[model samples]
Target: MSQNVTFDDRDQSVLNYSPGWFLTGTYNATSVGQTGTLASSSITNVNVTFVFPTPATEFFYFGIKRCCGGSYLICIDCDPNDRKFITIDAVDPTDDGQSPPVVLFSQKFSVAGVHEVILMNQPDPAFGGNSQITLDRFELTVPDPNAVQPTSATSANLFSTPTPSSTAGPELVGSASSSSSNLAPILGGVLGGLVILLIIVGIWLLVRRRSRRTLYSEEQATAPGPQFQSQWRPNSTFTTLTTPGTTISTTTSRRELDAGRIYSTYTESADDPLPPEYGQVFNTAGPSESSSLEPPPPPLPLKASR
Candidate 1:
């Protein structure tokens, strides 16, 4: 069961309850208690606050009614900081003379952060009794009129008009493919240039190696530089270079000698003896020198004796 709000015995602190919109009421109840009631001839007002924590762009729905058999006006007290309000008139009834219980109103009101919506009564000048007004339910919601929908703009009622489409044709697919193919030639040219650079570097290395070999052959031919000739010659002598302060030591090789023989025989007979005529020529005196001088002395002696 839904609860009912009644102003049974609420003493009039001021002329009216300054704030708070009436959510649910039976305003014609004539009860009096600590909880005050709204009457048909009594005048009261409803206050509302429109709040948005973020920058919200939505429409709002509010419902209102009157139990009395007269017209009533819902006046909105705009934000004094910013003048903005909505006025709804509950002036007519249904064919059965029943006033509309719930009416939804929405607008494209862009609110920044937070804003308050105040609902106040437009005190009518004709009636003087404590007349009454009632509120059922109020809500601020994004407009979604249909529960199940494929597209919001499209309606199940075919009588309603339709919105137009926003897309183009399939030629865009071919154009995108052609644009990608045009880039392939540029990529191939870059790869071909890199291959040519590698070929050039490889040929340069081959030429350098050939030139190095040619220089090495030229050095080799200019001087046969000592062919390693190993013709064995016995009893050859060569000077052995020694350090300035040291003698070059020749290692004596040992040879096993026959027990009865000696090495002196080999050294003495190894060379022929000098010729005896070389010594006789230097020792002989000449015979002609003494004979000539002695013959002249003998002739003089013979003359002197005769």
Candidate 2:
């Protein structure tokens, strides 16, 4: 499916020459887009532009009539800058009136795209002011539209031939940008995972603290405390409710009086005053409650007999 598209110098659409060009050659075989700018003011070169179709071409070849020709520059998708162009010069011998058309300049490109090949007519530096050239025609290796394309795997393994391009830094810059894009999501995932772990730890600590406080409260409520016991009997013989040597609160002593008696082993004389500890108890007691504490009424004497 490889094909060649040839453009004769007569084709005005392909080659754009500056002010010094004159049409002076046969049809389609050889022509002139050359300029004698050694002593001229016009500073532009001849440019051949090609618009490659869908399946682009990979190489170009230019046939020129070379006797005293200078150099042709190859620039792909770039403006004419003499500082950055591929130089292609044909051999120039000393005495030459005319010569056959030879491939003076040819180049192959790695990437297929729009290309601009410029031909600047500077006389050979060796023969300053004595160099000249004749433009014949150019050919482009284009692919057929119905050509069978390579499979994906085959394309991946295919390496485009190295080209004389000076625009190499942009590719490396693009690679660095893609690497940065890939790292962004990984960093975000790490940060998100750390935040989730912190929340879980906080919740666990809160639950542990509340559980400790609840257990402490339950223990305090069920602990042992003070105790009290009592038995009430109205109109009975006075009896001591508190154990010997044990102290009784005033509230308990008054409750005993309400049941009709308050007993104490503090009697020293029949008319002696009560002890200070018992003074409040007797002073507040009713006469019936006080008399219940006295010895039981003597048995009534029998009527005059034994």
Candidate 3:
């Protein structure tokens, strides 16, 4: 079954993307894409997939290099069978060179050079956004021979993979990585993931029914009467945080709710290292709502400065 809808230009809030292809391609964003192509489709149940070969190493990053408009679901080899996708929004409207590769999906394997990347248009209808996605470029992090490989999954695999602008992969030693290639580990992982997903779905459905019943009541409670409304808003603040070698600059909105309770709101924005998981929401209003959903495109050549 398909919606058969065509040619929709949706705002960041209500996500709905066009369609692309399984083309093998690459892109370099000067300040947004200059030499790349975009895919537009009219079907609601299709995926625009892209594939490329990556050399074996201890670490690698797969991101959309172009900073344009689209949302995509990135996966390693065939993890979880695409039943659920972690989407990265590539709808950044800013060209300040501060944002690209909107969201980064970095995963550490039991062994390197043993997996592949498959990107597709978001398949979850619950995402409630456009169905289109794009991939202009991919960034990879070849392992550093001088550093010991991380063995534990807890070891930060996220931003821990970014390299300085002058970084390069270690010289090829041998074909040992290829000789030891095995699928047992990845296959086991996929099975375990499916089990966990079933548990989550059961819990989620129970919660979903409750949430719907209380949805109207919660909305009604959030509205404050004239007497309870507070006109005073705390000054929004900007802060820059540095971890290891990466610097994250963030802006937070502190607002006084109706009962004089102050809460800080955080959303996806430029300078943030990671994108939020879809469906997570805060008490967003006015400017914050729009900014969170459209923070640059994901899957870019991550340029890190030392």
Candidate No. with top lDDT: 2
Report the error of model 3 at residue 10, Å: 28
Q: Select the stronger candidate by lDDT from 2 and 3.
A: 2
Q: Give per-residue lDDT, candidate 3, residue 41.
A: 38
lDDT of each: 0.42, 0.55, 0.47
Total clashes in model 2, counting residue pairs 3 or more apart in sequence or in different chains? 0
Candidate 2: residue 106 Cα off by (Å): 1.8
TM-score ranking of the models: 2, 1, 3
Could you estimate the TM-score for every candidate?
A: 0.38, 0.38, 0.28
Q: For residues 1-306, write the lDDT of model 1, one tens digit per residue.
A: 111112121323212444443422442222322222332223454443333323334434333344332334332335477655445544333323233334535444553223344444554444443334444333333323345455543455544643443563455556557768998998999999999999999999999999999999999889666669786555433334356676454432333332331112122233658544432323222432211112122111111111
The alpha-carbon lDDT assigned to residue 210 of candidate 2 equals 100
Candidate 2: the clashing residue pairs are none
Give the candidate number with the greatest TM-score: 2
Q: Once superposed on the true structure, which residue ranges of model 1 sit more than 4 Å away at CA?
A: 1-23, 26-45, 50-57, 64-83, 86-97, 102-104, 109-116, 122-134, 139-190, 193-197, 200-211, 214-306
For every candidate in turn, the CA RMSD to the true structure comes to: 20.8, 17.0, 61.2
**Which residues of candidate 2, in runs, are more than 4 Å off?**
27-55, 79-83, 94-98, 152-306
